[model samples]
Target chain A: MEFNASLIGQAITFAILVWFTMKFVWPPLTRMMDERAARIADGLAAADRAKQDLANAEKASADRLREAKQQAAELIAQAEKRAAQIVDEAKDQAKVEGDRLVKGAQSEIEQQVQSAREVLRQQVADLAVAGAEKILKQEIDAARHADLLASIKAEL
Target chain B: MAAEQSATDYIVHHLTHAGLVPKTGAIFNFSNMHLDTFWVALALGFLFAGLFGYVARKATSGVPGRLQNFVELIVEMVDTQIKDAFHGKSRVIGPLALTIFVWVFLMNAMDFLPVDLLPAIAQAIGYYGFGHDPHHVYLRVVPTADVNQTFALSLSVLIIIIGFSIKAKGLLGWFKELLTAPFHAEGLGMQIVLGPVNLAFQIIELLAKPISLSLRLFGNMYAGELIFILIALLPWWINWVLGTPWAIFHILVVTLQAFVFMMLTIVYLSMAVEDH
Candidate 1:
């Protein structure tokens, strides 16, 4: 049997191609893929960081809103307390003023009454003295006149 | 009687590999030696590597020359093919894809060399130097034309795929995948039939890998070599006229075969990663 040289030659060459290509070719190829994987991981980390930042912002905003709401309530309560205090002070001042006005009116009325009484007493005395002088044209006892005046005053 | 005996003898000899016949098992058959496979593949590998290096070194980064642009284009093509075929976290497949493309391309490109060039040179070297007969020297440059070489490549790819399958999915998990994947059917009766059917499909699929891989390469290269040999048989002057045209056209054929082989490898690796 004549075995062809071509078949033998072709077979030998193919084996080497497989050997070197596997050794040299596959390593660097895998490296590039690893780099790509690292890039994806970095991307995922960035996404995670962004999510965390968003959550932090949300929490911060909620805290601020709660604080603002609490302050608003406190401000409303303060305003109510101040208004009540002002109203109570005004009412107390009004009561004191009314009491003072009443006291002043009473004192003024007493003074006027005292002055009128004194004037009336002086007029009655003058009228009594004039009548006694007319009746007593002739000489009369001063003691007897005084006693009669006292009796008239007591009877009136 | 002599004619029938010669014909039978020819078929048996044709089947025998030109190697150091070993006296042992498949693993111990290191006696099957094929040196031309190494030499031609090495020669072409150096030739391609040199060409790429020379072109790249001479490139002006500002605006690439035609050769530089062409090299970049080839790289991009290889890279894009890699991206399309493999998925998830792969740290080894990209450069493997490129190397596969370049190595096979170089091997295939050997077909463009006058089918007689290396053999002619070997004959000359011996005829003049050692005074050995020119008729004794024989060499074939293309590797894929050899079925053994193609099968070797397929077997290597098979091992890698199996290795990754084991690595990505543990041994137990991978085995479980065979039992349960692609929709589960309940009950003892269904399991009895479907399990073996599924196992058989898996086996067939695995077997097809080397068969298809080897055959595809072998068919293309064997045809190309046959055509070149037929062309060489024409009158010497006429040989150049017809052979040169085919040689130029075959540049495309060789490159396409290499591309196909590499793409298929990537596809196989992609499949290995999938659960089904």
Candidate 2:
């Protein structure tokens, strides 16, 4: 129980052990724990970011899909309107051509009628002259009947 | 009556240390060293270093192994006590506290071994292997039971306290504190008159820390060791009857003493570093 050099030896040993533990053992272990904590935190943050990114991408794609659908509907409506306008123009051109053809045909009929009427008038004049010649018995005063012929023509 | 005589002789023989004998038959010699206490303490210290060193080497940032968990538990326990007791910043106190707790606990735990086991082996080795008479081979395995070992540990703590006090307060500040604390006087005459009283009180207070710290552990362990020895004096059949109960009870004493020693050391160091 008495004090001796062994006490000094143990003290020195204690000091060395404390120094060794402080220098070698403590720092790395504590650093490992701290590093593990940091890694877990980073992983959680990255997961959160990835989740947010996925949501954003989904939203963007959905918006794009909606816009594309709206554009397609607009394009179909425009095509239908253009088709209706083309059909209307074709109908109007058909109506105008029919009207012109009808007018031309009417004009041709009137010309033919006028021509026939002239021919008829010529034949009638010949017959009337012959009867007059027979009735008057001679080539008397033909020049004097010219005014009647003209009046007959004006009446026709 | 012969059995009782032998039992008294047995307890006295076991109490004696295995060390150098002074020629004058005097037991108190400054040069004397307890070889058994020395060897056991060194072996346990190596064991502490080896186990902690292995864990330190294999330590990872990933999931820990069983050994790593156990080592970390001890480390954390000591670290918590240090954090609680020591408010000031220090690099040394944490490891120092850990070492003291583990080393002293291991030393005290040596008492749990059957009181006769190591000594009997040492006696056999002495008689057969070394050709020494068994009667001359005396060994005491529990190191903390020895006043010298416990005092040595407490003295080291005292030294650290003094070193930290000087480092934190400066030499002049420490000196002034010693001479003028627990009572203050402004005038030169009053200061001069109060200096010796303050110095005496401070010295006593400083001296009491190591003494109480060492004696508390030594007294508990030495008494426990004695009781174990006394229990061992019973006949073989009755030995277990008393021995088992005492051994179980001594476990708390052993662990508590170590904890108390470590806590007091941290408290002392904290006091040394903090301003008055």
Candidate 3:
């Protein structure tokens, strides 16, 4: 096909305009946009990684807290058991000491009773001699009191 | 009779642009007017910006919804292309390919609209606002379909390739490449035959890039546009029969043009970034 002058003109015009656009218009704009796009992608990736890390840390902390609570409960149970055992031992020891002390006091009381009876008997003997002297003129009562005390002792 | 003349006139009028014509030898002529080409491109650019910008701005961190995912898929594909084909780090190339792909696609996509849709509206306003004939309205939207647009793109890539060649091979290196490359045979007498072969190869390779780049976009789109116009030319009754399939198939054309342009741009940039 025959080429036209106008077509040639159009072609030249197109070449010039394209050169102008490439040099002046397209370069800076595309550069800035590409940079922005790269930055945005990087920012998004960082955010995702950070979120994952945060979730992992939170789960780890929760697990640690649960484990700590279990340990604390076990320690408390052990302490309570130890305290109850010590209290039971003290109660048993106090009961044994009370029984021993009661037995010793009973033996001491029996010994005191025996000594008081002997003293009372001696006093009765003296009282009988005095009564005999008063009733049957004094010289004969002394000899009768000795016989009366001896007989009273034998009868008791 | 008047209607035919006027119809022809309207097409001729739309065909002519508000740009300066070369007085034959001018390498480049810039048009300050048609603020239309610049503004239209800018507006389309922003429209793209807004649609995609909204997707980016509203993107959820979770699975991307349909619109955002679709856009991201395209962007990733574009990026992977640049990464795969282009050598070295080009902070500028990936997005440049993106812009070219999107801009050209948008330009070509304009053809899909009823060819008369915009001009029809223009004529309506012209009838009242400017007190002109409605049939005289003219407009052409697809910039790449405009040969100047495609050539301009190819030339820019051409300049970039030149720059890369210079940067990679110093002037001395460039000269050495041209004179001594394709050093085919090592035998002492084979040097004579090698010279011509090397020269031809060099010439062929040098001519290949711009021609291929320019023609590839031009051929596909021009053919696609031609098919559309031909289909549109069909009678109303027959249109229904052929139109649906053509239009459905054209969607593939639209998507393919965009993909091809994107891949080629990446390939060219990759070549630019290479040492060879």
Which candidate ranks first by TM-score, i.e. highest? 2
* Share of reference contacts found in each model: 0.10, 0.50, 0.12
Worst 10 residues of 1 chain B by lDDT: B9-18
lDDT of 2 by residue, B1-276 (tens): 126358767887788788765323543566777788888998998898888877888898778888888888888888888888898888888778888999999999999998989998998999899999776789999999887788889888888999999999999999999999867999999999999999999899888999999999999999999999988777889889999989999989989999999999999999999887
Q: Which has the greatest DockQ?
A: 2
Chain B TM-score for all candidates, comma-separated? 0.80, 0.96, 0.76
For candidate 1, write residues A47-129 as lDDT tens digits: 99999999999999999999999999999999999999999999999999999998999888888887777666656765665
Candidate 1 — which pairs collide?
A12-B37, A13-B37, A29-B95, A30-B91, A30-B92
Residue-level error in angstroms, candidate 2, position B132? 1.8
Worst window of 10 by summed lDDT in candidate 2 chain B: B21-30
Candidate 3, residue B72: Cα displacement in angstroms equals 6.1
Return the TM-scores of chain A for each candidate in numbered order. 0.59, 0.68, 0.60
lDDT of 1 at A63: 100
Judged by lDDT, which candidate is best? 2
Q: Report the C-alpha lDDT of model 2 over A2-112, residue by residue, as the tens digit.
A: 666667767777788788778777766666667777988999999999999999999999999999999999999999999999999999999999999999999999888
TM-score of every candidate relative to the true structure: 0.57, 0.76, 0.72
Residues B1-276, candidate 3, lDDT per residue (tens digit)?
123455455445544433433223344444322333444455666666556556655655455578866766666677778778877765556556766777777777876776556656666787889997654444455555555566656766666666666676787776556655667567757766676777777677766876777677778766765665555556657865776787778778777877787687678666654544
| DockQ in order | 0.05, 0.33, 0.08
